[model samples]
Target: SQQGEEDPQALSIQEGENATMNCSYKTSINNLQWYRQNSGRGLVHLILIRSNEREKHSGRLRVTLDTSKKSSSLLITASRAADTASYFCATDGLNYNQGGKLIFGQGTELSVKP
Candidate 1:
């Protein structure tokens, strides 16, 4: 599958701490998007980084992509209990034969305790 695979399938952190997750994919991609999902809820888009861009940020979130290594990382700073959620990475590319649809990673489950 061309889907990305997230490392450290689960993570736990205290409030005010930082959390990081990693993802790796097998094929070339045009863009990668990160999404967050609360339990029993739909995903919310976090950020997107194009293949040409090395990094991007949104509020307390930071994302870095390395096309050469086919990997990406998401960092959340000063995390709160509200930030507890599952994070997913999705990619779009020639190998993603979903008719321009995205291929998603397994996802990383994050838990933040106050």
Candidate 2:
């Protein structure tokens, strides 16, 4: 499986602090997307950075993609209790062998303490 795997497995931080998570994949990818899932809820798309792009930002969320390293990182600034969730990185491989499927990481469970 070329699915990405998130590092640290879990994270714990206080409200107003910053949270960072890393994802590493096995194969080439065309684009990578970050998604957040609250307990027992569906995943919500956060940001997407193409393979050609190095960095992107949306509000307080920052994403960096390093294709050369087959890795990506997600940074959430000024974290809040509401931001507590499992963060997953999904990637669409450069080749369409998977029929345009997005391989997802195991996810990093984040906890924000108020």
Candidate 3:
């Protein structure tokens, strides 16, 4: 069974706007990560918030975790047409012995219209 599931499923915004996506998961996790994929290609790691960490940021991207709610959110500021892609949240599952394995959510497709 999938451990994580993305909410909304899709998002659309114009350049300079902010894009937000969310994810919810079941079971305890060592960490939660956000990733982006362009043109159906491989995913690019964005940011990760450890189970003990509440938030993290990278460049124009921000990630927040609320373990109490088993949920996480990703915010992308200054949206660009290039940012149009599929955003997914992933979890490492309940442990670390999994050898860096990741279980991904259904993904939220974001379109940054020019």
lDDT (CA) per prediction: 0.94, 0.94, 0.91
Superior by lDDT: candidate 1 or candidate 3: 1
The parts of candidate 2 lying over 4 Å away from their true place are none
Number of colliding residue pairs in model 2:
0
Report lDDT (Cα) of residue 61, candidate 3: 93
Question: TM per model?
Answer: 0.94, 0.95, 0.95
Candidate 2, residues 21-77, lDDT tens digits: the string is: 999998888999999999999999999999999999999999999989999999999
Question: What are the per-residue Cα lDDT tens digits for candidate 1 across 2-42?
Answer: 47999989999999999999999988998999999999999
What does candidate 3's lDDT look like per residue over 1-114, in tens digits? 888889889998899999989999988888999988998599998888999999888999989999999999999999999999999999987665889899899999999999
Q: Candidate 2: deviation at residue 69, Å?
A: 0.7
What is the TM-score (0 to 1) of candidate 1?
0.94
Give lDDT: candidate 2, residue 63. 97
Question: Would you list the clashing residue pairs of candidate 1?
Answer: none
How does model 3 score by TM-score?
0.95
RMSD of each: 1.7, 1.2, 1.0
Which regions in candidate 1 have their CA more than 4 angstroms from the true location?
95-99
